[model samples]
Target chain A: MDSRVWDNRAWLFVVPVMAFVLFSSLIPMMTVVNYSFQDSMGQNSFFWNGPGWFQNLLDPTTAVGARFQGALLRNFAFSFTVLAIEIPLGIAVALCIPKSGWRVGAVLVAIALPLLIPYNVVGTIWQLFSRTDIGLLGVALGRSGVPFNVTQNAGSAWAVIVLMDVWHWTSMVALLCYAGLKAIPDAYYQAARIDGANRWSVFRNIELPKLRKVLVIAMLLRFMGSFMIYTEPFTVTGGGPGEDTSFLSIDLVKMALGQVDLGNAAAYSLVYNLITLTVCWMFFTYTTHADSKDVA
Target chain B: MLDRIGLKRGDEVHIADASLELHAGSMNVLLGPTLSGKTTLMRLMAGLDRPTSGRLVEDGRDVTGLGVKHRSVAMVYQQFVNYPTLSVYENIASPLRVQGLPKAEIESRVARAAKLMRLEPMLKRTPAQLSGGQQQRTALARALVKQAKLVLLDEPLANLDYKLREELREELPRIFAETGAILVYATTEPAEALLLRGSTATLREGRITQVGPSAALYREPGNLDAARVFSDPPLNELALTVSNGVAALADGSRLPGDGALGALPDGAATLGFRADAAAAAVAVGGDGRDPSHPAFPGTVAVTEISGSESFVHIATDAGLGTLVCLVEGVHAFEPGDRAEARLDLARAFAFGADGRRIAARPAAAPRREPVPA
Candidate 1:
């Protein structure tokens, strides 16, 4: 084989993407970094704080620090609770989808309808549908002797938020799983049948192994989306009945807009992003490492 | 044994009423081109697919509705399917494990198959880690471990390299035949069919053209379609018009029609020959004067010299069209050079207008003739 000649001209094509990233993400993120290091007052007046806000945020004794800790734990709880119900439910739904014919197109279009809805629209729709005073679900629950209120009950508020999250995003997981399932060759199923494998053995040994890559992707996307969730709960429960459903995104917005504390909000935002990135990285390496080990 | 199997999907008939009797301890080759229903026929025989029409009886019992699982069958698909995440050892052991065989028995069987396929060293690696031939070998090893009554290999050697294909082409049929299983191997290469030297079934457009002993079938194809199916470089076709016991082409070349070609009811017909049986040489005068053979002036379109033979493409004069001639020993014929092509009439077969053989394998010999003025 001939040795490849090194060409540097390809770097010019990457310049446009770099410039676009600079304007779209890097510059704005630099502003948050600037705020994290300074103290801000009314009228955009600022003083040099030199990590003082970050120090207080990490201490867990200050008011902002306590709220951050509470919101962080609540985010973990909500993320796990939603994912536990969504993953298995998504796989089941994906498995039941018709493999071929016009019905496949119809069912796929129906499955994707919820995902096409805008976030605020989904939140508002659920709010009207679950209201205790005039909502069908709330009325039915109230009449059935189950205490259901978004405003006065913490347990009920958590339930509605979890249910709404599941309803909104299980479709994402299911669609990803469906695509993965469709990519598997029909020959694998035939070969398994010839080997006399039963249904569970086929799923465990064949389908699950083939689906691992897509499942990892779905897990990461859903984990981040669930951990940073805000819109549905904000419109429905208002993160209230106490701080039960005030996840990290809701708490960050509250510190930034509701409390008008720019310094604390900026610091919280950076740490929240760092946590999400670190956890996702850890999960990816752990799972992929296990994957290579499984093959080897 | 396949009894009148047919598969129709929607309005398209994929396998049109095909039947063959497959016996144990024998090697059978399904020779056909792509989309010729070779794989579909094999799938129907394996019970992987149920025929839309007709029944499949095996061992004198009807198995049209029987699933592949309940039947003792193993198949290596064209696109070899091994558990991508499992080691080669496990891939080969999968069937034995499913059968709940003892660990010692499974180990011995897998080891034996691995040895036969030369896959012993790569037993610990996965399919993703193996090359195409090694992956194919892993799939073959899996099929071997089953020791089933019916084994189907769909283009198993098509993806292998030239040397590996030749090597496995010899070993596979022998190994499967040793188990006394009904082995059905499908390939598009007619040379492969000849090499396997078993019973050969030639298929075309979902129809079985002919099935018999391989060498004898190649010698005397039941019809023109079967003869064409058994040709590697594609059969050469020429139009012949026979009138009052004399056959002539549009280019003024002539042949005595007292032969099998004339045995046709004295009208327009087709004459087919193999590339190797025809020869093309640079014209040095006296080109279109031979009456006992097909002699026509042509212009060389291409010349390919390979190994010990040369393939010369010539566009014949008149409306005879282009024909390929495979000449033994190297011959240099450049493009645009005038040449003469001749067919060995003794080896040619004549077909009627509807593509059915009028007579098999030179039923009438060409008689010596005088040059036409």
Candidate 2:
């Protein structure tokens, strides 16, 4: 017989959160779903279109489809670029931070300052900082005659957006990595040292393995955050320079709010949500299952 | 051999006057409770931590500056710290692979170590996937595969369940017997030190008070601190004033002072003995009581029955603290029962006011009653 006592009343504590989720997320999500299947004009009039917008969005030949495809590729490139730079840089920064002393607190707070800044404020700071006429970096580069202009050159816009995003978010990854590194008991390192492991071997065998679960969290957060990046780029570049920096969220906002294309935006958003969910699911499944399979 | 004398950190001293020499092909157990600087001393030996004072000399060379990676040392921790992501084979092979060994050599060593640890069948498994014992075995196998000259175990089996602890405790000495390494094992339990049968060092408050053969240390703890560290339920202590060949209890009760007790100078002293050295019997007849042995009247406060032995804790009428008597069988003495505890004064040790052992104990005599297994 099972020895576990079944107590369902404990779930009463979760009812508030469940009700909040229903009101905050599920109802809106259902509304988006409802919008995806119907065509709407002005004056709240709606007509059933039977997935017309979805078909156009999914087909590469259609205008909406081609736009979605471009934005998706841009999102992928941006997410991958930032993650590749941020993860290693974060780890290196975390390693460089002193393990103990008066400086650790100061360094950690400084590292976390960028993370604490509001996204739009960060965007505005970068926008002003990168302006050719008055910005610190922009004037310096302009004086060097590199022909830097986020408005006129696609490369400049892309570089600035990537750099700005990196500056704002790499600390977050570093903080997570630092916390993960700190959580590892000193015994593992001591044992590794006694085992004659060199510097690289210690990192490869002990530190890296211990940091796996934390890295998973960092990767997922970075991936999803970068994939749907809107505020900073929108504030600085506004998806300018011939759509060089327009990510999924930026393009979706332009389509829904600027162009008033609700049908296409709703369909676009559902598929966008689906892709993010799918990637996260794959990551979650692969990592969590791989370790549990090889039991003795 | 390592010497750690007066280890100072800032203005405070840790491990003062704690010097020990660990010989090859022998197990040296550092017996101490928590925060006794056991780990710090082991770290100094392993070259993981440098002693603020004294030298850790190996083969007549000072290597205090060299880091642990440069030394031939292996340490197993209380928490089984096997690489969570690596397979058992890879985990065992870790140290070997780090030494730049060839593929064939690493393979052979890992195979042998795996078989010895009985982890051969689980070579494909990760530490997270193994049982606690198997995980610890993986850690031990990692230490074993390196063939290091010095092996330090910081309470390796402390985290295991009681049964697993027992099993590994029996298997550990056998595992180390074949190796000629200088093995240093740290534990808080006196029973474990005795069972391991090594030169045991008793540490208290960061200082080692005694170091001798395991049984010798138990029979003759040179100081009160060492004896207290070596006891499980703790060595019983009673203040005594010795004069005219008699020791006076606080309540004006008298105990016959003879042998080791009589040898002490006529002055204030304390008597210390193991639980087994004292016996609690019915106050009326006092069966099996020696005529010369004095009985201290006490009321039974509590009784604990292990499988083979029972410990009767009696609150003595005398002002001295409660005395615990080890009985061989389950007497089931109830609380509030009037009793008299007959202490074996012949075997008891007397300590001076400075907490130094004042009595010169007799040479080794076979124990009359074995401690509870």
Candidate 3:
């Protein structure tokens, strides 16, 4: 194995990226930390509170605690729902796509189209598409008289948001799976055939086990993306009809930018970041532990 | 016939029709060069590949269409075909599992196979972790784990070092003896075929050219090509002519060998004899009148000595052309030494112009054992 050398020369290439990240993230983080330690009196005047904002965050009796927990639960629910629908569907689509020559190129282009559009554009497109008067989906629902109004209805808004996400991001999972599928040597399939494995047995014994790594990666990415979802649901529902469609990020933004309580917002942002990190860490630990158990 | 249970690549009708009958408990070696379709034929025999035209028959019943898994025939391929993902134990037990055998039976068979192959200690190791020889043994054990009726080995020892090959060659026969199954092994080496100690078949260009016991084929090949196929240094072939009672050569020198010249057809003939069949001696005092043992005077052209014996390539004026005489013991003979080469009368082979073996005359009767009487 080639041991890595701590070449200061390589830092020349990485320094720009680090600098950009520091400017974009570290500076804002320091500002948040500064705000998190003080209470803002009107006109940017601050009084030192010394973890007062953290105490308010921890206390369930506080208004902030109640709203944060509710939004967190809703975020978890949304992420799980999207994952439940997308992973298997993505895998199925990937498997069904023809794997040879020109046909694969066509299928790849078709699958990649949804991922190529910008994130905000995706939100705007869905926003317009789900409108009652101008959108085909809304028009069809209206024609069918299926009482559908995503802006006012929490269930409908959640369904549309989940569907929009599955439509946009399922391709990522499919592409990963397709790559995994392509990497499998044809000899393995030949061996399976010689073993007299039926179709289901082939899938169970070979395909599923081989796909384990990529599927976990796909699940983690989808979970993180769906958990932090903001643009599409926010654009469509405006976090409106009360707090019906307000996810965790939506609530955090509402506190930060809507209420202009910089101290409280900074505290909420820190809590939000910690929650995402904790969940992701837990997921990673669970999967790696399960894999080690299986290997043993 | 294609109807045999062990028919590998389907036999083609356009080719010569031949059926192989290997008795149970016998080891049949398929000997041929690479790409000569030995592996294809073995796969057909193992029921891995179906012959498009012929039927595979087992005990007079057609089994041509049966798949490899259902045939109860195990094949160890030329390539290391062990399952990379499975440990040695699992690989051996796979055949039993496929057969839907009981757990106890599977366990016993796997244990017995691992023990026989000396792979018990490495049962938990994956194929990649095993050495080349160990991997090959695992492949062999996997075949033997299921009580297969016919075991096909496709150059199973080709990948091993010479030392390992020698060791495994000694080990394999004992393993086969214990199993009591019909073993069909293919190899490019004639020595391997000889080591098999059973009936041997030679394949060339997808056709079986010859089949017989190894010793007989080595000693008295069926034809000129078969004779050439057996010898290590290869048999020496010379063109000869029959005129008067002498076999005259192109150099116009007549041989003094006492052969049944009367038995040969008049005109051209190719005399075939192995290098070892010629007795090398200095100009000896003998009449050379024996009709069986013929003699020729020739100049030694080349001498290759290896330990106990040396081969002298003789350039003779006789129609024998170039004769290789095998001389035992060390002799101080340079390339230009005048030498008398004697043919081991009974051992010489004669081939006709069309590359077929010609019959020789009946041997002279041996003298009675008067002293014993």
Candidate 4:
């Protein structure tokens, strides 16, 4: 048997990317780590606090600790709600798209239009669109005799945020599922039909199973995006009528930039990053493991 | 009664005016070249596609507008299509489950199909874990479990390797025999059509050129296209002239037309014969000067030895083009070697200019000892 020659020359191609990432991500992350344990008093003066902020942040008796706890729970709730709404709705939309026709491209483009908009622009658009005096949705809801105000009510704020998120990002999930659906050979559908499978059976056995990989990726991306969401909610309802819709990312920005508590904010950022990474890794591991079990 | 079954997409016609009657409990082979509408015809029969203008009648009932879901048909595609995520057992039981059959009945049927396809060992594994042939067997088992009245196999073995193809080909007929369903198999390979040994419908350019028993179609093709479709190495066609009920070749050799000429006006015609009907030999010591067999003098162009038989291609000196002859065992005739190829007139076919066979020569009498010339 011939063994492969070990050549260090291949590392030459990867060095540039490594250097770029080192400056772009790793160094900034290290900065956050450095700031997490140190207290800063204006004018670049710093003193090592050594986990004092972490202790305060973990103790719910304090005001900052209570805010962090509330924000963390709200972030988990938001991510779960977004996933629950988007996955099934995206699948339904993908299934509704015509498999083959002159209009397939047109429909796909229409569904993907929202995803092309900037995240801040999406937030701004929904913000205006939900104004009670001028915006169509708010005006329509007002004239229809319903008490709907995202600016003042936490429930309505959450509803509008979830709706905006679904409108803006469900298309990504749908497009992924559509691509997965198209990759399935026509023979599979033909075989299902020949087997006397009904519409539900075909969707369950053929389409759903085929879309598993794409759905996993979609779920992971959506979860991470929603967990780290700031721009959209910050622009739409400014993190709520109170602290109701302020997710962990918004709370981190508030703690670091609003109150200038760099040490506590940095600690919160690390914890936030850790939770997101841990959840995403768990999702990836579970899906790939389940996929392997299917093959075995 | 499928009257004028045709499918046209925009300006191009896929299947045009093709009509067929598929009998139950009989295997029918759709023999054609690539893009010959064989798959289109199978799809129409399986209710996978609607014909532009035709009515499909089954057991005296018209099922023209019926979709595949309502039709009692099972199809095995060229690609072994199975639910990749489901185990072989689930794949085979899917159709039964869709029909809401009892668990016991579904299990028994799935087991039986698995046994028939020799897939019992791999039933617990998914398609991704199985080899190509095993995956195809799983697909076949799924189709078999349905036990539909019409079973359509659209070049199911075309994607398999030679050994796997041969193994599955041998088992398929036996598997379908027990179902007693009307089996319609489509293939582009003529050898496969012959191996299946079923009634064949030859397709050409979206048209049903001929339909008959496989052996009869092979021995006496209805037209030139059918003959070409049914031949492996292809038939040797030569332009010849007929005069006084005798077809004469360019080399001054004549074959007695007798009753085989079929009242043709003496004129130019085409004669075709298989490679096996002709024998090539080096003329030595007057060995090949047989009076009964017409001989053409030629130079050996190429020789191919394939196991038990050899194919000798000879270029005639009379500008009659090259003729291929299949001889038993090996012949030591290299290129440029002088040789004579004797044509067996009994197996020759005469065709008119319109590409329709005018006559088929009768099988020759049993060979007698060569008399002295």
RMSD of each: 5.0, 3.6, 9.4, 5.3
How does model 4 fare in lDDT? 0.85
lDDT of each prediction vs. the true structure? 0.85, 0.85, 0.76, 0.85
> Which scores higher on DockQ, 1 or 4?
1
List A-chain TM-scores for all predictions: 0.90, 0.91, 0.88, 0.92
Which candidate do you rate higher for TM-score, 3 or 4?
A: 4
Which regions of candidate 1 are displaced past 4 Å? Answer: A1-23, A41-45, A280-296, B250-262, B287-290, B360-373
Tell me the lDDT of candidate 3. Answer: 0.76
Candidate 1 backbone collisions, by pair? none
Stretch of 10 with least lDDT, candidate 2 chain A: A287-296
Q: Mind giving the per-residue lDDT tens digits that candidate 2 earns over B179-253? A: 778889999999999998878999887798898889878877899999899887778888877776677766666
Q: What's the C-alpha lDDT at position A198 in model 2?
A: 77
- Candidate 2 Cα outliers beyond 4 Å, as residue runs: A1-23, A290-296, B242-246, B251-260, B285-292, B334-338, B361-373
After TM-score superposition, the amount by which residue A162's alpha carbon in candidate 3 deviates from its true location, in angstroms, is: 2.5
| Residue lDDT tens for model 4, A209-267 | 88888888999999999989999999999987988899998988888899888888998
lDDT of 3 at B257: 54
Proportion of true inter-chain contacts also present in candidate 1: 0.56
Model 2 chain B lDDT-worst window of ten? B364-373
Which candidate wins on TM-score? Answer: 1
Instruction: Identify the runs in model 3 with alpha carbons over 4 angstroms from their true place.
Output: A1-21, A99-104, A124-147, A239-242, A278-296, B1-52, B75-94, B118-142, B150-373
lDDT tens digits, residues A1-296, model 3? 98987778966999999999999999989999999999877886888988888888777789987887788888888888899989999989889889896899999999989999978788888888878899988778879998878877877777778889999999999999999888776635644555555777667756776787789889999989988888877887877658877998898889989899788788888988888899899889988886665521
- In the predicted model 4, the residue pairs found to clash are none
What TM value does model 4 have? 0.85
